[model samples]
Target: MSRKDRDHFNLLCDIGELAALVTGSHNIETFMDSAVRLVSRHLKADVCSIYLYDESAEELILRATIGLNPKAVGRIRMKPGEGLVGATFENLHPIRESAAGGNPLFKYFEEADEERFESFLAVPIQRGVQRIGVLVVQHETADYFSERDVMALKASASQLAGAVENARLLMDLYEATGTHPEVQAPASLQFIRGQSASEGIAQGPITFFKKSHVAFLSGDAHRNENFTVEDFHEAVRQTSRQLADLQSRLAERLPESASLIFTAHFMILKDPKFIDRIVHQIAEGVSPPEAVKNVARHYINVFASSSHAYIREKVSDMEDLAGRILKNLFRRGAEKQENEKGKIVVAAELYPSEILKMASEEVQGVILVKGGITSHVSILARSLKIPLVIADHPHLMHLPEETPVLLDANVGNIYIRPDQEILLQFAGQEAAGKIAAASPSTVCRITQTGDGTRVRLLANINLLSELSTAKELNAEGIGLYRTEFPFIIRPTFPSEEEQYLVYKHLFDEMADREVTIRTLDIAGDKALVYANATSGKNPDLGLRSIRFSLRNRPLFEQQLRAILRAGAEARHLRIMFPMISSLDEFRDARSVVDACVRDLKREDLPHHPGPSIGMMVEVPSVVEIMPALAREADFFSIGTNDFIQYTLAVDRTNEKVADYYRAYHPAVLRGLARVVRAAKTAGREIAVCGEMGHETAYIPFLLGIGIRILSVGPQFLPALRERIAGLTLAEAERHARLLLAEDTLAGALKVLETPTSG
Candidate 1:
């Protein structure tokens, strides 16, 4: 070979040697040192150092160095976008050139750290889209690193990432179990809240999460065994075989989505480039730990300092890979660990696959180390009503697996090492909550006040699937049936025939209960499938509900025809209009309803003899026109949630003002009182349907306001009914009057908590 080719050959040989050292050594620091030393020697650079990306800190941290001031070994760090390293990190690309020193992105510090490095190459180590770390190599001589060297280093860096990942995995395995004698039990428990989606009681031991438990364990000790060269070779062979076996098992179990991630892990464990580097370093008469640590440091540094965004993302995976490889090499006899279902999984955060691992019968509750109320996990938990907790105390990781833990999902509290008193008490409280939520709703007849005034308790229906919920809650009849859900999910407005089929089933299901069908009042933020109601920037204030129906008369007429035809077979059917802010909107809508009835008659369609027409009291303007609306309409359903938001000109979805979002605001109450009183005077039935109806705390207040019909989500009916069944009308009315008279809502709410017995 030519001299230059021979030198390149030697460089390749050196890299292989370093990889070998990595395979044999268990210590991360020693592996990195050996690798950096080789780079410095081969390049004849005054200072050759690798700066690794610290995933947790989101900064470049110096990992290993050669021919530099000893103080600079581990002290250097730079934020992304601050210097050459940062620029490389930010752009996820390599930066290396003779003129790189003069670039604005490169900031040179004039400290006495051995010698200044004018030549630098920073490449990002990545896995797929995620940036793991950056790899950096610097020299005192300008132009020392050419394009060819950069390419070679880039390739070398890829190999390095694999080594580092293996070492990290080994470290993780050691840290996970008591094999690392230094690790110990955590000091406390972490707790968080998740919606009680399913109503069931379960108690099981806490499984501590590694990320959550790390704070309790001191991870400074090396857990690798000391060994001779022959023993080390044998260990490497044994570990590689073991890794191959474990990988095969993992492949069989992982979902398709996670296959790529695991594949990367497998490749890292088997990468020849990584294996050779460590073995070479170990052959240089160095201790296995020292060799491993040195090579690991080098790989970690390069991985950390890498500028390629894709490559940078691979640093963690690389570290994990390297850790695993080391663990296999040194801890050959260590038992393989896997997530055991039928046991509580304590985790800082669970990926979707991890959640899927839970058999519905096995997992009772989920305790998260950190999550928010609006997080995806919590939202899913809400949809399922699974008890979950997030952001608890840090020591939750120390709890023993399969040990019974008292979990309070409401308050985000999990009692680890809970005393018998606390456990028994919490169990009793949980049981009561479940019992209260599941007890049968009684069928109560509407009674008059002391002076004999008739009260009507109607039902609110949103989802067609929840008709059964109304029956369980003992609703007198369907008072408010929203007809927008079908239009929202469908690609086009449901045809008249399609609409009829849906309405027909609902009418049939409520054969005994009176059914009130609202015409497509799909406006505001409510969208439709095939309608000209284009979305506005502000959907809440945009065209929807009654406005959309009125605008699209054809769609409205078709829907009306279907309702009339379906209503003909109903036990009791009524038509209601939503968002009738003024008498003009109400009268105009009523005229259309009249037109629909006239058309139905012309077509000889069967419909109720006289379906009562009603209007939804959701706007302040509606309250103003209540006297007129009450005179014309047969009944009124109070959409209190929207009424409060619109009256206050507040967007309930806006976080900044959401705290002020209250259903019981005096303005909302006043509007509701005005409409209900007007409807009462006209002898029209009024029902409260919205989020307010489902709140157990507001059941008494609603009853006090003479809102006999309560429309709520299916899941919330039990508690709401339980609250109502426990109260007398006289007591409810007295509390309602006091709540409305109060200046602040907080004081009014306190009135409801007076603890009246069932």
Candidate 2:
């Protein structure tokens, strides 16, 4: 073998041995010590150390080391972003220095006595986005570490990260249990990590949240086949009404986003395929509860196995729907128990309705065995300020009810049977109210650059309940009020009166400010089963947005009439059509609006003389013909989320290509620049209302590109305003010009990292 090939083979074998050592160990100290020894021996380094992130202290604590002061372990610490170690962790990337002592970021620890080391190499140990720790190796000789050495260390670090996290969690359990002599818990108190849906900390008794299981009736088919189709149909009707009631309650108690969950449940209950299968099962002489369970499991398995993450998440909604129906069919009721203040509710999965019903002053937090950050229940938890941790530990469901536990959703952790010190620490953290007060001040003020370039900051809202938050954050107006919400929440199409009520309410709330509402943008992927909308094979590229509305004229006219009537009730109303791929689509939608106005006039109804019309500039095709569409539309709203996705042909929801869906790609920046220039040439007002607008790093770029109106989620308004108020128009323009010259996303991102002023 060649020398280089032999070296590579030896490195792989060393990494394999290290991985085995780390994975087989359970003690934090022993695991960490072995890791450093393995790294030092394999790399032939003078010193090696591991630092675990202490979130509460906001510092990196040296956990274990070799070839340096052994006492430095558990004693040495560095604040995040303090030195080379901190910088490596903060950037989530590796850093190397041949002459470590010459670098300004290098810090000396007197006790460690490592000032003699002249070479440093460090890599972040991470599990997904969460930073577990940092791994470091150093040598007394300069230029001792090669690029290949860094690569080998990085590969070892990745394998060591999970083991490090598990060992730390095991240690925490031991300390909480007050077990001396370092005895590991029988089960190691597994901390099943998940995405943090809400941010808070709470400690209370864990109460398992479960629906009452239904007992299916059993008898000989020939002797007791007495239930009729009407009986099965009646059960369906009752379940529908119950779900509707829950929807109303959620809408009243939480945000419209939360209530949308029950809307999904309502759709599932009325799904033709699902209902037909259940009815068929009933006709085969199966009891109602048994049929519901069988059909639900079949759908759940099918959805759970789907390639799409969003589709797989729908399995939870299906399970919730089936359980609710079975309960209704069996006439089962929720368990009656005394309401205990500050209880931590645990469940296999929580539905939106269940979350809303559980919302009380007494309830402290929530723990779910299964849930996603995008789930409706998660949204409700955030809206209501409840701490929630979604963990899938096998023992979680089997835990005894009312068991004392600590739920730290801020870090996405749950501590079962926490000890006194841990409980006290959580109590102190809670008393500090740090997470609750994390949001900036609610003072209403106009945002402008240092040079006095006026910027209108608006809110993008999906529910009326969010308006109050927007108002508190001093949003200049409602820039993108998604109108598809009403359609998604109803079992059938919303009538003119029903749609009018919602629009009118929003108009009344934002009475003095401009409110731009985007029309229904639903497609096969987001279609309401009750709407009879076919699930096209390629939903994203198929019938959706303006195309769907154009084909369904009645649905289009009904919404337009309601919007116009609501505009009459409250001025400053604007209607925007989403996914306008062509000028013809915009013109067709405008004609429907014109017809609605004529009908309103013919009926002698009170209405505004005319409301401003706009089109969402999301598709690349629209950018190609923007000037032509600009002549007809009153204004333009750039939807960066979809624009980037379509421009790159990368599905943001597809994990395989999601990493390539870059919002700051050079192509996307050029597209935005072209749209802004087109709007300027046509003398049309333009605004941005997408996730990009909410990003602080993108703020300077957006402003630099001449986008004066920025719309974002209400929670982000404060931080965005602060960022905007710190920049000058000239600086932003200069930055924009520099960004336009970039040919890669990395180049564009690097421009953002530089100080905007300098």
Candidate 3:
């Protein structure tokens, strides 16, 4: 590499570090200023400036600068194609111009003091085609800037775009909540930002729930006396007993999720990977306690750092299992002691049972210091009506005990030591929020729009116990029966008969109503131990869903045969394949089902020869070939979570780029429309069996776009049904039209937030 190239590279690295520093700090203005100053100084430029794109206003406003009139920084604004900076943004390419003022695209802004510079270079700062800003540098001499300079600025801008955009988003949210990311916080108030896992406001003293028992244990972990290998084995046995008891108790309370919630803990306890690793450490002369901690940390770090969100959810389980083992390591029959009643509990993460225990203890709310919202935990907290928030702030661990904490999970914000005014406002809002819960009894048997267009509201069954809730909520049928949950109930995959019993029960419970059972959609990265599954990098797009099924043909056929056997006497049954990306993949999966039928027939076993075969409309490739896919698929169900994730290239659970996971984006909306249109053209049925169906704002749009079926979490059915009751078909069409017309996320968000009316 040339000396100048190396220098430019080093400069980019320095700027990347600077961007990371600014992300944590409140002053984004300082980030912009420092960025411009560094670029100007590094490149020996006369001026450098940052122009942040204001999406709402459709203009790029100068936010920070070096060498220009400082007074004009916040005052100057230009629309796309209005000036050289605007032209950079419009063209979405680096602009390197000598005698820059001579270019017809360049418009002089009198307040900016740019006339002194004869050379200009500007790079459009963007995050995945979303315009963030423009970075500009000027030189005193004409044609002073070279390709190396342009390349360096481009690299810096690319690295800084995410930081700038995140900081910008933080500022906007803060502004909405009457706080400022750019301003210094008061001594009395500390705010922690996180995603709202559950809805509602909660205020109480912050109580840190310590699960790791290392603090209470006496002596060094690596050299503890009397705690030998036998003692560790005994603790493992005792931990198993404790888990069984906990599961039994949880069954009486939260039966729906209790069956397999503790299964993970046991799996970790007995697994050779966990147990043998710890034993190996002890054999290496480390004490049992230290060995356990070492092995647990190894697994926790592995799971937490996984690229896929599925594996990330296992971080909490590892912690929970470690805590259980540690608690039983020395203290036998340790009483469940918690002084967190009516107090806000702050934890790194909580498994489902921990959440339940907190709820039982009358805990006001929970603030998770780390970890993403696991499905089990989120569902349990929501079911228990406890406010939960996942705060990414590092300050959460150091919070003084018993300090007043206000958790506004409804808005996904936490305020530590909130003042009197904030407390009073929340108290008033909480009181106002007491208008009566949406009753399941109010949901119509046949849900319809105000104009009498029938809409089928199905339930997403994750467990057998959820059947009661689905029935009570008037769900028409099981739309997306996630078959993988049954797999997680045991260590290895369930045998054909075991799966049959589960499915048979489901069919019997739902009676004659159609049940769309998705085949095993397990990913390799999750905690569920499978002998056949192999971990890989980027498991989200790796052999998952249908790909995994096809790769393991025997297991795939086993599951299909089980579903078929169970649905032998059932009048209405559907088998759906997840993550179907292509026409050939769908045909391959369907052929397996056909083979399963032939095997069942040849064996003289009773089986459903023709269950409805369908595919989940999740992969982006499926959307393009929808018409052809619809012709082959007996029906189609859109898994909006993965669909939107795939469509936007955003990890739905990732909080860093959570803002980009937009369901209302024109591409996603159009994709859904095209699928629905294709299904109609082919005379095939399609249902949305994802979380989007749970959103009230999205329900109208779904209906507007001719989606007649919405399969949501059973708990959401009541509110969804109520929301649909107030909207006419015509109004929904209008809402859909507005959404389709929107080219920007901001415009789509505005349309979604607006109340529907003709």
Q: What CA root-mean-square deviation does each model show from the true structure?
A: 20.9, 29.7, 25.2
Candidate achieving higher lDDT, 1 or 3: 3
243-312 per-residue lDDT for model 1 (tens digits): 4454344334321111123333444444544556667877877655455556656655665665543334
Clashing pairs in 3: none
Which candidate gets the maximum TM-score versus the true structure?
A: 3
Error of 3 at 433 (Å): 7.6
* Candidate 1 Cα misplacement greater than 4 A, ranges: 1-190, 194-455, 521-532, 714-730, 744-758
Q: Compared with the true structure, what per-residue lDDT tens digits does model 3 show for residues 582-635?
A: 999999999999999998787556789899899999988887799889879999
Number of colliding residue pairs in each model: 115, 0, 0
- Report every candidate's CA lDDT: 0.60, 0.72, 0.74
The model with the greatest lDDT is 3
Ranking by TM-score: 3, 2, 1
lDDT of 2: 0.72
Q: Residue 359: error of model 1 in Å?
A: 16
